[model samples]
Target: MTLNDLSPILLDAAAPMINPRDVDKRLPDMIAGGLDAVLATAGAIEDFRTTMEDVAKWLEIERSGARKIKIARSVADIREAKASGKIAIVLHFQGSDAIEDELDFINVFHACGLRVMQLTYNARNRVGDGCFEITDGGLSKFGRKVIRRMEALSMAVDLAHAGPRTALEATEVASRPMIISHANARALMETPRNVSDDLIRAVAASGGVVGVCAAPFFLTKDGPATLDMLIDHAVYIADLVGPQHVGLGFDFAEENEEDYVYFGYDERYIPMPPWTFPSRIASHAEAGNLESSLRTRGFGEAEIRGVLGENFLRVFEEIWGC
Candidate 1:
């Protein structure tokens, strides 16, 4: 294959419009946007049966097509997808609610190609408290067990939407490095969803990565959520723990935002609608804008590559071991 034919494996840490059926329609956009693989949300806060159904959708997608999109369980699989011009799909979770008291189900999900799992969504669960939880009780005993099991099974844990107490505890308690899969620096913008520098450093010290999200609210309030605003978050984290600890999770939703479902708190039960939650990243095609942003900020090619995907790729290799 020619050099241009086999580009670098550009992975978006948190991509949306990610349903199995919907991915077929988005494949052309992903290719045009220069994304080689994306860690897509497969199940979040759904029941076990619902979770299995979610995974089955991807399985069916892979079985139906030899080329369009496929499941990727390893770094090698992601590389293969890049070489062949296919968007590798890494099934991940935004919360652990789907397992529902089933610790052993971690293994089941892992075997089914689930490579990442978050402890909580936006409220408390069996695993831990989410960012929106008023009580912020933190990680439970079962939550610790879940982290241990995930480490043993090579299923990486995410703390992106976790509460402050839970995020701190996960960083300290995890035997393996855990990721804040998609969040920005709260130092840049004051929001509950934005991560603090303390948590960012803790994640880097734990041998983990922090993926900066480009959501509007997370970026800044001074002006429009431009690519510069996104890099500011990356620069902040990179300044703290070095570029090796920084990465991109854009969290861009291209197709249907309605594909994501939550089980923590009902919108009617809650005071506000979570759908109104900030999603400032304009489009998945904006994925190509990141390289120039990094360069403008004086990031070298290697550093930019790390923030792009190599840094995340390193963490996956350490966890997956293949």
Candidate 2:
């Protein structure tokens, strides 16, 4: 059995349509599509208390017993889940806003089983400017310290929605392999949220991987994206930085037309409601189609495997060292 994967936010109060605990409803699609693990966001620009609650919710899901979902705090945990026919959930933060001004909060969250965190969201936080910021000042003095502290604690730093300068600058500060969890190559799609070739190379130079997102707008300009468009992104990054530095992170969210604001998405960066992901592989159940599309696009077995999930797992092992 080949490994295929897509990452999604497990739970969001704003998007109540998604409930991972419903094994009969959603878990089958994920399992049938071979989604081995997900990077469940504990918080995105929320404060400490709310973030901790998010963590608690995930913990509750793990204990729910309604679904075979296990929280993977390490690579070993991931393997264990895979062997036992359970879905592994990697606790993640889409942004570091939960930490507020304190760097010690990173340690606390790590202790609470947060293995990955993005430095910023669509807008700036105390750490640095996000992609939406007018002036890309890069990381703050405190942001640099946060990076050092995270590295020491073995938590993978993500640059998904960070500003261009901030993402590049972060690579310079981060000694370990970092990730741009769910972004497309900006060279292909000229979105502010997309990662640049320079940033992609910088991330790869540090032995990191960039996961190609399946968001329709991020893939193409005007139309709903297709699986071909998604593979085009994978091919672009693979050709640029090699297949080992590429992976899949389909940042899927089930939101009502009105909850975008509640989710902290600005109108400037996000498209209007009823946001559609790429066709053919729209949801986790259809994600298996990606492998065939990649093969048809002239991707080899190993390259396709790396783009599937092994690439991200490799970087996780490097940072987590287990």
Q: What is the lDDT, from 0 to 100, of the residue 175 in candidate 2? A: 90
TM-score of each: 0.91, 0.91
Residue 311 accuracy (lDDT) in model 1 = 89
Q: TM-score for model 1?
A: 0.91
Per-residue CA lDDT of model 1 for 179-292, tens digit only, reads 988999888888778888889988998899999887665676555567777888889898889999988897765323243233444333232223222322466665777787
Question: Which residue window of length 10 is worst by lDDT in model 2?
Answer: 8-17
* Residue pairs that clash (backbone atoms under 3 angstroms), model 2: none
Report lDDT per candidate.
0.81, 0.81
Candidate 2 local accuracy as lDDT? 0.81
Number of clashes in every candidate structure? 1, 0
